[model samples]
Target: MTKPVRKRARETSGGQGRSRPEEPGEGGEEEAVTFIAEQVGALRKLAERHKLDVLHYLLGMTKLEADEHLRLRSKRKLS
Candidate 1:
């Protein structure tokens, strides 16, 4: 029979957040948002080239939101 897994004190303890552990160099949420911002910038350029005004505008907004998220996270860490 298979045994059930158990949680450790450090692994539990209410912990504020970060319940699920991540592998090294996998680049967590912040990295993901930064990557999204970079990609959105490139996509916005492509949309502009294709004369997609609405699409370009949407991508610009998306990039701004991602940037804002990073900014807010940084402020939280400072606090």
Candidate 2:
């Protein structure tokens, strides 16, 4: 007879699940967003320098998102 397969711990565990995403106003999010924006901006410029238009465009969009996050976080702090 063939051996039966066994389920992994994660598969068998009913309570295990993904954690919630961090909201913009939460602590530590601002620094993370700022760092991501900086890194993505650099990558975007590098992609531009190499003529990788598609990759550059995608990174540019991501950069915009991070910048928006920073803006909202700043606005919330000001309020």
Candidate 3:
């Protein structure tokens, strides 16, 4: 013979794992968006600087290859 299993009661509030819902106009979402935008802008600037350095190094090694790289980079920027 098998015994029936009992269901555990769910906590409504004031429990160990209870969490509050986010309210509107709290600015949490807006702050996160602003922070992400700033980080993206900073990363873009760093990438542009790194690309310029790479272009300079490539130019010293091979002008034709550097020109091709620049052309491709410009095409990517346009798209």
Candidate 4:
């Protein structure tokens, strides 16, 4: 079996963990919402083309549950 990977300790400032720098010209949060909406539209079309039943099931999930499950599946695939 493969062993689990460990995360390194994080850096902190003023007793709280420091955050990574943001991207330059990352448009306002609304841009992020728009981008995600576009991606979902594309995914839906592709799912229909491929007849992906699992993708249909995932999309039917409540928003929070769908996102959490997709994130977990993506991490597993990457590993």
Candidate 5:
């Protein structure tokens, strides 16, 4: 049998890590949202075309549950 190993704490500078400020016109948040939306759309289309219940198989969720989750996410995006 193998012995348990102890983990060491990570070292940080001055008890606080440095943070960088966001620059103007970087399009960071907007670009991320747009990319995710495109990918989700593609995945949904692929699932439909292949007649695969992807979420049900991969996530172990019922069809109704997966549909509800997608519906709620779209509703949130609208608002």
Candidate 6:
């Protein structure tokens, strides 16, 4: 004769049931943060690979503005 098996109360009575730990929600926030970080990193790498034209345009505009400021300063010195 063999002895029958006993299940713990924490386990579900249904067949083929899955059990989870008794606590607060799982670390879903951490997983979301990790996923967002990976996406941002991929975007940064893509930006680096494709060299944004807008950035170059902005830099050119800044240089032009600085040249105008210098020209005005020189004109004021001559007056």
Q: TM-scores for all candidates?
A: 0.70, 0.66, 0.33, 0.45, 0.38, 0.36
Instruction: Output the better candidate (1/2) by TM-score.
Output: 1
Question: lDDT of candidate 4 vs native?
Answer: 0.62
Quick one: best TM-score, which candidate? 1
> Which clashing pairs does model 6 show?
none
Off by over 4 Å in 1: 1-20
Error of 6 at 60 (Å): 0.6
Q: Is candidate 1 or candidate 5 better by TM-score?
A: 1
Q: Candidate 4 residues 1-79, lDDT tens each?
A: 9999999986654555544445897774445545565566677767768899788556534334545555676698799
Model 1: lDDT equals 0.92
- Each model's number of backbone clashes? 0, 0, 0, 0, 0, 0
- The deviation in Å at residue 20 for candidate 4 is 5.7
Q: Residues 1-79, candidate 1: write the lDDT tens digits.
A: 9999897656454457644666786888899999999999999999999999999999999999999999999999999
Q: Clash pairs of candidate 1?
A: none
**Candidate 1 lDDT trough over 10 residues, lowest sum:** 10-19
The alpha-carbon deviation from the true structure for residue 47 of candidate 5, after best TM-score superposition, in angstroms, is 0.8
In model 5, which regions exceed 4 Å deviation? Answer: 1-27, 56-79
Ranking by TM-score: 1, 2, 4, 5, 6, 3
Off by over 4 Å in 2: 1-27
Which of the two candidates, 5 or 6, achieves a greater TM-score against the reference?
5
Shift of residue 68 alpha carbon in model 6, Å:
0.4
> Tens-digit lDDT track for model 6 on 12-39?
6555644443357554433444455555
Better of 4 and 5 by lDDT: 4
lDDT per residue for candidate 3 within 25-52, as digits (tens), equals 6555335445555554555566567787
TM-score of 4: 0.45
The lDDT per prediction is 0.92, 0.88, 0.57, 0.62, 0.58, 0.56
